[model samples]
Target: MVIATMFDHRVADGYSANMFVSSWADITRSQPPSFLPSFRRSVLNARRPTIYTPSTANMFISLSKLPLIQVDQKNEPNLDQDSLRSRIYYIKGDQLKKLQLLASENGCQRSKLESFTSFLWKITAKYMEDSGYLDHVCNIAVAVDGRRRLSEGEGVEKEDLMAAHFGNVLSIPFGRIHSKDLKDMPLTSVAKEVNKLLKTAANKDHFLDLIDWVEDQRPKPLMSRPFAGTEKAVSIMVSSGQRFSIMDKMDFGWGKLVFGSCYAPAARRDYYVMTMSSPVKTDDWIVYMHLPKKHLNYMETHASHLFKPLTTDYLKLYD
Candidate 1:
């Protein structure tokens, strides 16, 4: 059996999906959910005297202000709307360790997310190079959930049921590098750049600015950097699922959930990557990627070992 859910991205970001499911499960069992959700926007209000950090201002303004990029006909993917696709890939703990070791050897201390982002960024830039778009930009948007950051700053303790705090509390900070530089730069260096971009939004002020910035764009749409670029441009976003409570944690009293993943809507032109822990093997991860077929084909052809395809046998669904 399979279950699917749909939520308005503007209203509920990825993290909210878990709470929504858990709440439904609680009702089914005739038990009150551990905590209810709060949809208060004022909780994220900016300081009384409006202050703008340059970085925060740039992040919120540049994307919305930039003109939409246009791609010529030759660079377009050779696929009709119906032919768009998505794939599931798995990465072992050992593989991640190897990459980490490689980074350390190069005098870099990179986390799993940074390492993967750097590696994928290089791979994507390679595709651009191969397609004769060496000067084109390749950006990686890292999705950061602001719930923990906001709560901690607001003096909300760990034991506090933040289940009540709900809305689109998310900040997307991304890194952009042209294909030419990505090709010439080392993996560690590229990852370092990506790490730096992510750090810019890892604070209380940035999120508060994000909230106020959204308010400023009231009647207008907030277009992220990825969405502002052209179809040919490589704009991939990775939403970290390092702490997603799935599997045994999602038990609705019937039994533990055997497996879980995302449900992508119709056609998506840009790339999106998400990762979760492996239930069977500790330290391993299951990656879900939705991207252009050409990019997937290139990765599958060149780096197949790094991304294992999911199968019923591997997951032991029937066992």
Candidate 2:
């Protein structure tokens, strides 16, 4: 029972698309949908006073303040749509656990996704430094779902109501550091940085402020702050699909799902990574990556032990 879904990034993000797939699978199995789709716009209505903070402004940028395109990209080649590539890999459970341990050694509990994000951030920084962009800014962002966080203290009913709400209820909190500084940071320090960035958005106030910010900038285009600046920057977005539960919950009377993973079109030149649970190995992960060729090559060469290529042998598809 393998299923594929495609979404336009302009309309919906990965979280909203995954919710739709989960709900669709539940209905197909004759089970009550876990999340009933809610299209009410009032759920995310802007505040009357339109209050926002500097943190909200830092997360996103209005189109008006964008600087003119720089023509001095001598070492950096133009990354056209054709240059983007997609690859899939399987990460062993033990490796993930080791990363988690290393990331949490500072006494702060770090999730698996946070640990992995830290590792990738370091790798990206190294690549940038190797490419002679040591002083350039490198940013990594994690997509945080705001449903539960936004409804905190409102009671379970309100939380469930927000859970059932359909749309992009997401906030991207990112870390911006110089490639030289980030590359020199230890894994634990990098993980702490990742955790600190996540804390900025993992609360109710942040999302509320974001809603108000969007309202204040209504009718004008907005983009993530990392992508808006004219300074040399390399950005990547990491999303988690561990909660999708597709392998365990998406049975449509045919059989359990053998293998499933997301895909991105090569024409889309965005650097993104998604971590999903493996269908065969409960603890393992199937990483779907849309990154630059150089970055993927670096990962393959430097971190091959952690990222094994996905193949028929691992999935037991032929057997």
Candidate 3:
């Protein structure tokens, strides 16, 4: 039941996968899907007059100047980019509920994905600290589906089809916390910080402003936060798959799809994490991570109880 899928990072992102798979299901069922793919460049076409917020301006400046997502810094010659590895694990609903309770006790509120992200963030910070990079910046770039937000930015009503528009519309918003501070912060506190930054970047106004910014920089390459810079840094980007309708939206005659998840390109340099739905377990989740081999080793030994490996037997793919 473990549906492992790897797509070109160029053609589709996390959000686009749902529609892509659903379309295939529709074809198999000989039924027309909800809507055809919309690749209209006009969707994200730059605005005539440019606009920007001070916060986004600052972010753009940092991305333009800093080496935020470096693979292997000459400074950290010991680390090898080719040594990166991938792992799949499941987080039980009960376990996630306990973590959420622990987070709530600290006077912070967050969704399951955010809570889990905070957990991973802390773990990553520890790895950096152990590697003597406590002062280094560690970034967590989160992928936000910008379709609804972008449609809203354009003053489209919620009842409008644009709200549910199918496209490659997305925003890469991130929070940069120093390793030392992240190491010292409480779990809930980290999640709160993450939530705040992501909210600003994922809101309707942000997309409007992003369009303006792109307009101002016409004819130039637009780079996301993670792809920018990272001379002395540790980073991870997480994408949430909470909204994908695995049970209903994907049923194009297939008796309820069992499971679905994304696999990143093998050659990707930065660390990545994806939280996905469990086909069988309603409250549980499947977390896929592409991270450093050494760090994966540490986590496997230290927190293996929490992140169980996904085997073919677990997926019931074989007899």
Candidate 4:
């Protein structure tokens, strides 16, 4: 069985949507949900006196100041949404293991997601270099869920409460490097950069501070900081869906759920990459990409060994 949901990004992010789907599955199976959804507004209320960190403010830009930002000076125009495209690919488990090993070489430990993000960042930089946009900044962002972090040190009950907390509890932390710098860095070093960026927003204090920051910015629209800056910048959002467990647990007595993935609209302008576990292959990954046509073509031509188009053959559905 295959199930899918189309949602509005303005209203909710992927994490919230994933929770909804998982909860639905739990109800269907007559089992309690692992992460229950909590709707209490006080759950994320701003702290007393509303103290926040400057770093929290750095993650987002106020809409009022957005018009003054400069466009890429290299004469590269903003990407046309019409040129955006989506592709689905599967990465073999062995390939991911090898990437992790390479990224962790020389006494540096890195997660598979971090390793993959570094590789993609490098590929993007390479594309920029080939296109004569070496001066443009390459921005890579990861969406970090803050529920557990917010509940940290509060006891298992609190943690469970947070795990079930519904709505958007996400922070997008990004690292920006000049294309030339990214092009010159080793894969391990790039992975280190990714880890460093993620560490900034993956903590309890960060989320609490973010809540306060949002309280301070109320009534003024805001957006992820990376998206608001340089016109010449190339930015991509990488979200991890490994925790979703959709394929294995989403079965509601309808046999096993197979071939589940996200579908980003082709007309959306931002670049996005999501990594989900393979339904049939335990160690493998199903990568969903929404990026520029040229960028996708570049990856397909240059990194064919690492990224293979997802097909029925890989799923072994045909007898």
Candidate 5:
């Protein structure tokens, strides 16, 4: 059974998404040489599909409370190094089987696997410092669809059917706990925390309240990016854009997309994870992750059997 769904706007193919990207490139290219070289270089070198990677350089404006200083802390438990170490692990075959089992036993879906895994990793890292598990915190930010939550009446059937449903249908509910806490506590207790957060965010009324809260906080308009103060947090946002009706609409001269997924660059030390429908097989999914090298190394050593490397062929990166 599908746990969540996404509705995409009708577009011929992934190429259609490139139109806006191309325009952005053109705009940047047409700019005069007097423009800032850094900005000019960024646009000129932009790729067809851009992935947002978090960098500790010049992105943050230091406030009085937190000095706007960039520190190199790969050896320390700093956000700069931690975010770089975070990575996405792809699961299939037997590993997928084990994950499904864990999700089923916990009365959840495979979508929750990363957070669950992160929870366990954090715990093990704490007590067994010598275990080589990196000291980190794991937080799962589940994406909530706001279409139904914000829609009027029973909702327009056609709008729901079409992938064109726009507006902010996205909401992220996060579950955070330290690695040491998981290590000292039982799995059941950890699961409870995960479930509690999921349930609270799943409520329709709760989301409405959230919208109100955000409106009051921002007053004007704001983009949905990670909060600045959360630089030290190891949070992962999980979004399921598989149900977007647009995947089937890939017909801009080229054949239909065998699969479609989103790409998230390692922007911060915090974990960023996304799961989308695999074009190879509808039942399967393709997960894209950009994590730090240290965490990726640790996961590979310990959980190597669970994750399969996503090759360029599978993602059609060559094409």
Candidate 6:
């Protein structure tokens, strides 16, 4: 589930309607010429032509930690102004292994991808318990990129190159993992359930069907994103293949970026996670997440040992 803290109703209102419309308009306007060189070079250097390998240059693993229990009225973090703070935890090595074991027991592959994610949800549940926020329901919205599936080709060239050609092709699938179930079940069980749900929705046809379904439900035509009051549940959106190769190409004659990450504002209290290529290191990914403050605090206290600080130097958000 995506969870964001808004300082006032006005900010939330602005984000819910106006900002989205403006952002959408800007996105529809035109593709900047600055991106052309990168796209052309990438396409031209295609040796295998069927498979595109993600850069493994400067990979760094980091974790986001949040509190397990809900923060009550008295314990809630200060939000007097319009600024709010939240955190996301990262898991690695042994903790990741444990998650893999859990996933294996739950009938899912013990791959790094599956294990790491299972651990996050497990920790999210723990945070809810520790912070007294277990009563609410949480949803995990997996944002699938539809370009490869929607494209008209049948090779890796289409998949790898399309992201550069098509700007923001995406589909949000609601992985509605309830808070109660997440709290009660073991990590393994939760992994199984999550794996099942994700598998069912991870299909080209499923995306096409979703498109048709959304088109059919017009009048109040809405984009398939979480936190749209579409489900009244906590949901998160996860995007993979952190399009970093294009970053080097995005230079306007300025020095290359040491690192970069996607930032999500606290508009919806529902959780949001974006997995992008780690600019500092290629083999690693930088996951930008915005979740509840209570959960953030819990991870800090309990899972402090797992994550590296998201210092400005590492993310290059500054300079």
Task: Estimate, for each residue in 285-305, the C-alpha lDDT of model 3 and write its tens digit.
Answer: 888889888888877777776
Give the whole-model CA lDDT for all candidates, comma-separated. 0.73, 0.84, 0.71, 0.86, 0.46, 0.48
- Model 6 deviation from the true structure expressed as Cα RMSD, one decimal place: 12.5
Q: Could you give candidate 6's per-residue lDDT for residues 95-186 as a string of tens digits?
A: 54555675686344666555556666767766655556545556555555555575445577666465444223345544556666787777
lDDT top scorer: 4
For candidate 1, write residues 37-111 as lDDT tens digits: 777666767666666666665554444466665656676654333544688877888998877665553455788
Error of 2 at 169 (Å): 0.5
Off by over 4 Å in 6: 1-83, 86-102, 105-108, 152-168, 223-233, 246-250, 266-270, 312-319
lDDT minimum window of 10 residues, candidate 1: 154-163
Q: How do all models score by TM-score?
A: 0.89, 0.92, 0.85, 0.93, 0.60, 0.61
CA RMSD (A), model 2: 2.1
Off by over 4 Å in 1: 61-71, 74-83, 105-108, 157-163, 230-232
Ranking by lDDT: 4, 2, 1, 3, 6, 5
Ranking by TM-score: 4, 2, 1, 3, 6, 5
Which lDDT tens digits does candidate 2 get at residues 230-293?
7778889898988876666666567777777778876666688999999888889999999878
Tens digits of per-residue lDDT, candidate 5, 134-221, equal 5555555566665455443445753243223323334555655665566666544555566665666565555455544543434344
Model 2 vs. true fold: TM: 0.92
Candidate 3 stretches with Cα past 4 Å from truth are 1-7, 43-45, 58-77, 105-108, 153-160, 163-166, 246-255, 316-318
Instruction: Name model 4 segments beyond 4 Å from true.
Output: 26-35, 68-74, 77-81
